[model samples]
Target chain A: DAMVIQNPRYQVTQFGKPVTLSCSQTLNHNVMYWYQQKSSQAPKLLFHYYDKDFNNEADTPDNFQSRRPNTSFCFLDIRSPGLGDAAMYLCATSRDLGLETQYFGPGTRLLVL
Target chain B: GESVGLHLPTLSVQEGDNSIINCAYSNSASDYFIWYKQESGKGPQFIIDIRSNMDKRQGQRVTVLLNKTVKHLSLQIAATQPGDSAVYFCAENEDTGFQKLVFGTGTRLLVSP
Candidate 1:
């Protein structure tokens, strides 16, 4: 029943260390998304990948990068973690795009020390 | 810049009563509006959605109402139960080919028994 899965429910990293979060989907979705959500705030889109094409948000920092190795696997890499990067990292997937309902994973809580 | 926001940050309702969460959006060109329920320590789950051409849509015990004239959206939960307590968010699909989702500030729903 677990369609979308994110490994390491909680992750801890040093301020300047690089960290990567992994996501996998059993739904065979073509589009995957990454979002960062701080306490009591809205989830902001960091970037998304449609197949092999990656799309980054205008406000997304260069420190954040994403990779989709295949159809079911995607990774979010924070090159240099900062205090402000401590938040929930959510991974979502959609069948195609447009009006499709996006399925979300349980999320990974990242803590930057 | 398009933004989505909630009218209230928190809402408390009796278990047997109905709960209504409101959201406002600045983008009128959004193709689809979706409602998501997110519990603590979990990612968002899709509840219901309404397209720009539709005014209302229903799913199980949840109903999504979209008022394009006012650029407003609302989610109504019938016969609220304690399990329904969570944060509800309204997201607008920007339809920018990537189908970017602009999420609203979440409204915390507390169903008290």
Candidate 2:
């Protein structure tokens, strides 16, 4: 089945170290999104790519960045991991059709020591 | 501009019972709405959706109701099962430019057997 896939379902990184999470999709969607979800809170939008165009949320920290290398793969990078950055990272994709629904990958849970 | 939100933080229901989750949005311009279910250690999965033109839409065992006038949305689950226990969220999006979806703080649904 065509679906979204994430690598390294669980990630551990030392404080101030860099970590990268990857997402791949077989659905051939036009938009890919990255979200950070902490315990008991909403999944906050970090950034998204409309093809190669990147759109970052106003409140997203500079420590977080994303890249869509091509149509099927996207990567989320944390330049310097902090303890507060430990959370679930979600990746999603949707078609360009105006009313299309998004498909999400199993998230990568990051832990910063 | 869509400010999607949910009314409750948590809900408890018995297996085989019906469950209702409610949400409210601030943007009337949002033309598309979706409900998602997220299990522990997993990503949010699309459950159902309703358009602004329609008040209700049904899926296999889920239904979404949209009340544009009151800016309210609700999801109904029939014959709820243990596997249905998860955090549920509602998201809204506009039909025009920048198809960014705004999601609400989720409601944790506990289905007890």
Candidate 3:
């Protein structure tokens, strides 16, 4: 099954430490996205890569950064982890930038201590 | 700033009953809309989508209705089951250069046996 995959379903990091979350896809899609979802809230878009062109949300904090080295892999790096930043990180992929459907991974749950 | 929101924060329905979740968007320029279902501890799964040109779209057991006049979107699920219990969100895609989505607060659907 061609799907999105995320590493370390659960992550624990100390406050102020840096943490990296990874996402890879076998769907061979052209667009990849990263979203932060807190409890009982909607998934908020942090950044996305449309064929390696990074597009960050205007309100996204500078501590959150994303890199897509290639079509199949994308990483989310948090420069300084905070307790409030602990949430589920989701990775999604879509064929193009239009109204196409997006497929999402299981998500990486981050816990900041 | 424009936003998307849901009228109800939570709803409970009995098994085999039909469920309807409503959402309202402030962005009149949003051309695309989608409904997503997020299970506990997992990423959101795409349910259905409706475009501004169309008034409604249907999937296997789900249907999406779009009312451009009022900028309201709705998801109707037939034969609600326990498996359908989850958080449902409505997202609108802004008609910008990029495919950015603004999601609603979300409505929790609880299907009771």
Per-prediction TM-score to the true structure, in the order listed: 0.95, 0.93, 0.94
**Stretches of model 1 off by over 4 angstroms after superposition:** B1-8
Residues A19-112 of candidate 2: C-alpha lDDT, one tens digit per residue: 9999999999999999888876667878889899998888899999988999999999999999999999999999874678988999999999
lDDT of 2 at B103: 84
In angstroms, give how far residue A24 of model 2 lies from its true place. Answer: 0.6
Q: What is the TM-score of chain A, computed separately for every candidate?
A: 0.97, 0.96, 0.99
**By DockQ, is 2 or 3 better?**
3
After TM-score superposition, the amount by which residue A59's alpha carbon in candidate 2 deviates from its true location, in angstroms, is 1.4
Question: Could you tell me the lDDT of residue B10 within candidate 3?
Answer: 90
lDDT of 3 by residue, B1-113 (tens): 32334353999999999999999886899988989998899898989888889998999999999999998999999999999999998899876678578888888999999
Error of 3 at A43 (Å): 1.1
By summed lDDT, the worst window of 10 consecutive residues in model 3 chain B runs over: B1-10
Better candidate number, 1 or 2, judged by TM-score: 1
Chain A of model 3 scored by TM-score: 0.99
Query: In CAPRI terms, where does candidate 2 land?
Result: medium
